[model samples]
Target: MMIKKLFALFLMLLWPSLSMAQTETITHGSLAIDRAVMRAALPGSKVTAAYMTITNNGAEADRLIGVEFSGAKKSEIHSMEMDGGVMKMRPVTGGLEIKPGESVTLEQGGLHLMFMGLTERPADGETRTLTLIFQKSGSLTITLPVKMMMGGHKTSS
Candidate 1:
């Protein structure tokens, strides 16, 4: 009985780290992609968004040309802007550029990945795969965790 109680206490102490979402970094050539996360899709919602940071570690510049995700029928790099007191979202044309030794962050209310026609709605704690195609770095595949947005912050569900 004492051993069982101690084991339970140990698990309780380790629960937070076990339940927290883990951030993963994937690299290809001189490009490193990190902090990749997708928002949990609400019920009956066919669209969702993802965000990440891409860093260029080499001397040459590169462009993010395309994205691939099997869970969605279409994926595009998008940007949101306020135009004359109105918010507008549009697809980024000609790809996004990343200069040498610079990091480009795709985040909410700015640049992000727009996934439309979702074949599967992502739930909290789910892991999804995303393939990023770059102009110079080629293709890099990264795994992203689906996190719930609560009060403008990400939380594990």
Candidate 2:
């Protein structure tokens, strides 16, 4: 199915990070979030991004409804697509869906977290707490350690 293939592609892109950060996964009931990291940004920069993998372990689907952080003036779930060799990014209109027993990855050049109007620049090697609201799980808070890059330590072009 198309959904299966898309999920598989996400998994493949996330495979390297998963293999390297096996111990970094955080689980609650039927949900798990892995390798959640925020990219480093220069001061005065208006935007930054975060990446992670979210998994549902139960026999029911869930949706990631919202993301919150005090450091940014605005936080949004964004998706990126390549159009004729051009990369375009935009906010995801609806919430991101997660299937039962399935994992969804948010990474560079795809579905990701976008932070704008940062109150303060994200610091490297430091941790910031991010609250994720799920359709079924209500809210789950996790520490997002600020890092220069993610997923095999590769930076975006």
Candidate 3:
């Protein structure tokens, strides 16, 4: 058992390239966003939902501090929790913690970005630009293609 553990450690240390290799092409570490989407709400509504995945490839954990986007008055991180038989959605205080070499997916029915007071509805087949701010990585902007729903999405590594 000890020998097997040593072999694993050797691989992780000797082949740092292997540890960095992932299914997705990561351009930078500390902050990243993927599969971001904005769903259209009812007309004259003040809220819309956004979903995505975040990854941190560094050796230390990172924090997602905030998010910003066009056509919205405000954006915040929110999550759903089950209380008894009722499922309630609430703001995610203190941001999100992303562990080293780990990925966290924010999707529908789970954690998502709340776009409030949209200045205009996001039409289909259009892309939305979202700027993600991290405590360590600063800010990153990624253009997310709007999809009908969260389906067929996969996380790299």
Highest lDDT against the true fold, candidate: 1
> Quick one: best TM-score, which candidate?
1
Q: Model 3 Cα displacement at 5 (Å)?
A: 40
In order of appearance, the predictions have TM-scores of 0.80, 0.78, 0.73
Off by over 4 Å in 3: 1-26, 150-157
Tens-digit per-residue lDDT, 39-125, candidate 2? 887656767888899999999998888899888889988888878997777788778999997899998778988887788778788
Question: Using lDDT as the measure, what is the rank order of every candidate, best first?
Answer: 1, 2, 3
How many pairs of residues in model 2 come into backbone collision?
0
- TM-score, structure 1 vs. true: 0.80
* Model 2: CA > 4 A from native: 1-22, 150-157
Q: What is the alpha-carbon lDDT of model 1 when measured against the actual structure?
A: 0.84
RMSD of each: 10.2, 11.8, 10.0
Per-residue C-alpha lDDT of model 1 across residues 1-157, encoded as one tens digit per residue: 9999999999997764464334356667898787889988888878888999999999999999999999999999988888999767789999999999999999877788988888899998998999999999898888889987643322222
Better of 2 and 3 by TM-score: 2
lDDT of 1 at 81: 87
